[model samples]
Target chain A: MSDSVPAASQSNRGDDFDRRDAAWYVDRLVHLLVFLGGVSAILFILGIFVFITREGLGYLTASFSPSEFFGSIEWRPTSDTKPTYGILALLTGTAAVSGLAMVVAIPFSLGAAIFIGELSEGKTREILKVLVEMLAAIPSVVWGFIGLSIMNPFIIDAFDVPVGLNVLNAGLILGLMAAPIMTTIAEDALKAVPDHYREAAEAMGATRWQVIFRVVLPTAKNGLVAAVLLGVGRAFGETMAVLMASGHSVNMPTSPFDSVRALTATIAAELGETAHGSEHYRVLFTIGIFLFLITFCINLIADLIVRGIRKK
Target chain B: MTMKIAIETHDLSFWYGDFQALFDVNLSIKHGRITSLIGPSGCGKSTLLRSINRINERIGNARSTGQILIHGHDILAPEVELLQVRKEVGMVFQRPNPLPLSIRDNVLFGYRLHHGKRGLKSSERDRIVEKALSKVLLWDSVKDRLDHTATQLSLEEQQKLCIARLLPVQPEVLLMDEPCSALDPSATEAVEELVWDLRDQFTIVLVTHNMAQARRASDECIFMLLGKVIEHSETGEMFVNPSCQETADYIEGRYG
Candidate 1:
């Protein structure tokens, strides 16, 4: 009986069990494919940083002046006598528009997040979440179109401004563009706070508003700060909408009604017109590097704050 | 002599989105005593505890049809204030859930909710914090670091803090739902001792899965099976001679 069993087991151990079959090779192939998919994100970011730095290196080595680039507002790059590439006006415009966008977006997004994450139940929450995601998916170009056609006319009619395409128009458009993503992230932060905390607070006779303001919001404060920072990053890097709405002028904007030009808008509008190896092209690449560094730092800070909370 | 009933329930039935959890549960828990509800998993003990303060209504589809009276007041009535019901009846969860605040603030959280911050002096707040923390036997350890976050404490201390936070409200009934299930053996013993100490001042309804815990810690024992009370007697009598066959089967090693 032992001999017969051994013979049967040997026969059963055919090529499928003894050797690597098709499944083994397919598994190895999938492993390699997934590894590449994970590593490609880091690779793309590094490649873009290197390429922009190389393109801007010529201007940085030869004619770049920190004071001239950051202090002066003159940006006449096509002058016959002398060309100046100072970006003070562009910096102020970007800062103003982003600052104003944050002011407009913070309350709306936080209120929406509180409603969706804390107040609403089943169907209302699901529907509002889907609508916010759809709003985030709307293209920046379409937002630009709205800013140019609808908001421009409304501002002109309402405030009696001579030119509607100014800081107020662009800031309002960018604020709307940033609100959906901010709302989604803030909702996620509020959701991350455990339900038991709410239960404990409610069991202690706290009203709904008291529970939210005292316990839930305090627990999710770090995540909320990260969400606001991410929204600021989004507002700072926006180009198409700001270009279409900001009137694209190189003026130091002293008021919301003054026309201005952002750094991103300047790069987008003038990159195609400048010669490939010219100083103007290199300066635009330098602006790209500045933007890359700012957004990268903001995201890094947000990530660190999130990781801090996780560690706690 | 008659025992005063702190919490009385009549014809209590509960459902969680069409799944019936409790059917016709009528119980009168006496004041200033530790009554334990012992059963297997999904026996509706926790549900019943949550229903005392009307906190079960927080679940979206949870519904109950019954009269739950706390000190002769119908808490389930429409005109009854929910905040008032909760203030009079405090609950402790199986898992320790201290608020994300300092130790002082956590102890003062319920007090601050009931009393606004406008007229509350800092010295008065400190005294309240000390009194609540001292009641749970946590003042000696955590008094030095009152400003530290409450979540940083050990699980045993966190559970103690959870109890302490409920004391400032001065609730008559303290409903504990497996308060020591998350603790280690030693922590469980400490929490059980604390619960026993507090029995003289507050009526405690403890839900426990451990039969040993029910046998040792409770004054009155309640045996439940399949959402119905099998027996309710003195802890010694219930353990010595359980009247119902189902109660005997559960108490013994036969089946849960």
Candidate 2:
């Protein structure tokens, strides 16, 4: 009814224009193209997951019976009439090695992270951070060579261990590789805790250690868990290092000094020799499926735990 | 009222890198009396309070050249133990901050730090923790759940817990910098009452921008402008007969 009415409507009109700006024919075409392009990429990648399962899962089932599969421990699958496909030994080996690696890695990494996050001087902190970050960027193959050439012998001598390429040797080497990544990520998480908590602690006459233990670590629990999960993911997928230094045996681990067979090593060793469509090849694929499931479930559980923490 | 110099600072100056935060703040504070420092933003009221507890020394890139004596101990001297100075002088910040600990642990943490688990068992620690909470008037509501995390308490209760957390060590001085800045009116009143109750045992120095609160709570008010202490006088006299034009200007809202 008045000029003010037009001014009031102008703000709404501006909002409408904003809502419609990206809806013109050209913009719509561009958006549609992007959506289609992303979907196409996903479908193409997903096809690999499907094709592998289709080609691989059938071989394991057709090659061996449930009884044979459950009971067999020998993994030296050679071309013969009576084939063995026992993976209990292999599965146990991988689980033991991975679990041991995590145990060795978590405490040292978390402590170093807290030191870097809380106590280090500015220049020293940056240098230490750079060193850890560089470790994370180093190739897995390089780590393997270093472990074989240097770390394995030290383990053999220091602990008076038997085999140079046993689970303990491999696990220790892998733990070293994972520690830098764990430290860097956990440090970042600890840093995410607000300055207020630190000040509050100090104001209450809390020593620096008390502040770190009671406040910084608890507040950054989500981030610390994320770091550990990420470290586990790296340890799971590692192949060259585990293959090279793990002594590559199908034997179940008795202690840190026993040789072991991780899933990745089994696949790597067998993939080149097996003929396509053979039972061995299918069984190999099934092992791949199982490995993928383990890693997937670990990550999914970690994500759920993180989400639960955030909701609180 | 008996007047005694509880704490004193001489030619006190502080800097954060090249920027001066406090400039030659020479003031004397009385024991067991509330002294309110009122000023506009960037006027260095907060800086003065932090220096009293020697907390400013820990801020990275911050330096001070001053002689602050807490109960006649040279706080700014190189030989003075920072921890001992801190143990005698406590602080409460603008925002309510409770450590991520059990409510009971928060109160007894000081004893655990300074004494290292000697001369007190868990039972005695709990009693002192309870007594500290009662001093701040929070024991009744929170007594049922001493084991609950301090973070779960309401904002005001957390602030009171912060105050209570400082009591067990029996600090001679309490420095509060804008303690009610993050609180509602009701919460602010509760804290004001606690401050008044605390004056019997602790020397209280508070910084506030709220003139009404400054008038209501403080016995002696020190007015400042542009990092200079304008007038340090009794609250009633300073408001009625301000000696400086800058103090009058700030009080009347003419120019900040």
Candidate 3:
């Protein structure tokens, strides 16, 4: 309570002065700038999502029900009269092609990843890794071109179909395009697992395959799921490859050999020809919303499954 | 009543890409006894333990020469399958590395690997789990949460679970490479108690830097310096009466 109190308060005042120095202000200013920089991309993405939703919401009026958008298969947005906007055909086409692509890709990519991560060594492993990365670097348009020029004819000859551009053809091409990415990601996941797990499993007398499937794969389950989700995402949103490979016939895909049209191709082909802010243009935005929602749901479901595995 | 030799390595030498790690390690480990390999850091105690089960060979460039005989079978023979060798000798690592799986699954991991999954009934597998967990004294704490992930357990419990997982396979020998090095003092003592309890059933070769643990836990002790065995004697004799100057220096804590 005596003179010591004033001395302590004087030191506190000096500390406050130090806290408000030029260096401190500059540090805070830099931090703010970095924080703003980090958030700008997220802000732009949110802006796009909100803008698309605002434009798309007009189509959900009395003239167009949500069921018409989701339930019907017809997609004739340009018909002067009786224009039907059913997206079921396109949706089925996307689903079928993407599903088939995953089925074709998962086994081969996972096996290749395991082989590279667990089996290969020295120059062989190095060469395989470089080749996989190079495969990933190939342009999507080139993959589309390859599918159209080479695979279409092969499929047309093999199945004796009049049209080579079908769900199977598109799916096989998508699978090939997605393989390098899936293998690279899965291999990274496998290699990231601590060596201790491998040693423990091998010590328990597990064969290499057993160790890979039982220990390594399960340990890296989250990353593996991420790899598959990213692969499926790439296939689902692909426009050029699916458009070039899949015959643009808006029909319900009854079989793998049936020609189909994906939602992305429809938008790409029609958006340029439609009048701005017209009903057809707004419907395209609605389709964009659908694409966004479906991809969002797939990611959410995959995340939940990965979380469940982690919890176990 | 001389015990049978459970494991024997004759002139065993190991190399990692031209850098020799183990040089002419010759020793016979007796059945149903605890033998501790004691040494300073990088003294090849852990290397010798791994070589017994061919775990050292997992490294990309690691190569070994000479014979390792287990139960009268030469494991280092060209015809001998590494799978068979590994199956016969189980190992535990320094860190508790339980698979990201349920506790029950971890216990049955080795069992299901050796025996096909369909061959064993639920009740049989349950019995094996209970037996193994009880052996390591981990049943009471984790008995309620068998479905919980093994990683959720404490370091002590996880280490115990790691030991329990090795039991279902009925391995002839168990190699522990500084298993308690990652544990606290209390957990180290607890694991040492479990290791002592496991004696006389499975042949145990433990690599440890702790002189106290070697003396208190192992029946026989092998002291190494720079990849060469300095002395192999009874624990009490090694501690009370060390023959080699290096062994005496290590025991006296003159320098590691």
Candidate 4:
């Protein structure tokens, strides 16, 4: 019986069995490629952070004053006599516009998300999702143009304000811009909740509305909050649209009709005019750093909230 | 004593988008007894169990032509309210799925749904929670941690809590689709014992893949194959003197 055993099997043992074939080499190559692809994202983010800090470091250390930067509204970067670098007006501008944008966007985005994720079915859900994504795909520049041409005239005509471009115009435009992405993220959050939770709740005789309000909402609350925070981040970082529709004036916006300059708008409007390595240029970069930090902190909080849900 | 019918299905046929699962399934389950539905996989046992409470409709394109009577009322009728049907017939899934809430809230969820949250004193809610937990024999281990999340419990405890949450609504028929399948042997034995204890209070329709569990835990046994009922008899009679060749073949471990 031992002699009858195949000679090919005996010959192929040990060294031959351990041989790496073409497929093995290909698999290793693909693994290395994927690993590099994953690492590149982190590398690019770090590179951007380093570049921004290097450009802004001079202003942060030497000429930066806590009271002038945060406590006053004077932001005359090109003044021949003692340029003022205060950003209080710009900070309030961003805050007022983004806060108002959130007030306008939250209801529309969350309602659309619930409809898409929980209520609609089959083709209707698919079509609505595609439409919302298409809304997000519209260029930010085009949104700024609309704020300039359409909402500019409409706000003046309707609200009877002096200038068409102000916090109201910028806020309405930014809210519309932010709603689509918020809807998408909120919908994903609602979808991430297991279908088993819905099944269990429905089996317990919960009405459709009751299941959404009581069970699904509570379970997905963290993700929903993260979605809203991401929307806030987007509103804060937006520059071109806010610049166009906010009338590009530096002031503490006391009402929706008052024109104001956002932090991002200040950097965008001044960086090109300033000579390289000058205090003006560095101050613009300093504003860039501040914007970066605010967005980073918002995103970190959103991530932690999402991670809290995963731990449970 | 005359047997009271808790559930009766007349010529029930179901389809999942033209692929029929249950074909002309007729059954009469007695009240206040445990009836175990035993069959191999893909024999439509779970389908039948889910159909009792009309939960099968949750799957889009699932349709049925049947008359399901519970306590002499045709629950399949268009006029029948789904919430009312679900309140009368509760279900437990193969895997335990506790809501992401406190154990106390999970126990009170159904009660609050049926009886509005308002007008209920804290003492009354606590009493309801304690009684339901005690019925499932879980109060002793978890009495002190009532505010803890229900999803944090062990598998056996979660399954017990799943069953306990159904009691506050006072469901007459409890449908269990392989409740112990996710548990280890010892947990299975404990859950089986709990089911046996519940037979005196609720009419339980248990769908199990484990033949030994059907023999040990149920009063009546049903053997099904290819969506057809092969045998329905007392547990002892079915094991010893099965009337159908298929039932004998199945019980004797000849073939599934």
Question: Among all windows of ten consecutive residues in candidate 1 chain B, which has the lowest summed lDDT?
Answer: B222-231
In model 4, the Cα lDDT at residue A198 comes to: 88
Q: Each model's DockQ?
A: 0.90, 0.59, 0.72, 0.82
Give the fraction of reference interface contacts each candidate recovers.
0.90, 0.62, 0.82, 0.74
Interface RMSD of each: 0.6, 1.6, 1.2, 0.6
Interface RMSD of 1: 0.6
Per-residue C-alpha lDDT of model 4 across residues B199-223, encoded as one tens digit per residue: 9888999999888999999999999
- lDDT for each residue of candidate 2 in B69-101, tens digit (9 for 90 to 100): 777777889997766777888889898888778
**Tens digits of per-residue lDDT for model 3 on B36-153?**
9998998899889988888888888899888888988889898988777877898888899898789999999988888877879889989999999999999988899999989899
lDDT for each residue of candidate 1 in A76-137, tens digit (9 for 90 to 100): 88988999989999999999999899999999899999999999998999999999999999
Candidate 1 residue pairs in clash (backbone atoms < 3 Å): none
Backbone-clash count (model 3): 0
Q: lDDT at B167 for candidate 3?
A: 92
lDDT of 3 by residue, A160-237 (tens): 988899899899989988999999988988887888888888887788888888889878888789889988988898
Q: Is candidate 1 or candidate 3 better by TM-score?
A: 1
lDDT of each: 0.92, 0.84, 0.89, 0.93
Give the RMSD in angstroms, all C-alphas superposed, for model 4: 2.1
Instruction: Specify the highest-lDDT model's number.
Output: 4
- Sort the predicted structures by lDDT, highest score first: 4, 1, 3, 2
Cα displacement (angstroms), candidate 2, residue A210, comes to: 2.3
Provide the clashing-pair count of each candidate structure.
0, 1, 0, 0
- Model 4 per-residue lDDT tens digits across residues A1-312: 989876776655676777899999999999999999999999999999999999999999997898999998998887888889899999999999999999999999999999999999999999999999999999888889999999988988998987989999899889999999999999989998998888988998998899999999999999999999999999999999999989989999899999999999888888888899999899889889899999999999999998987886
- Model 1 segments beyond 4 Å from truth? A1-19
Backbone clash pairs for candidate 4 read none
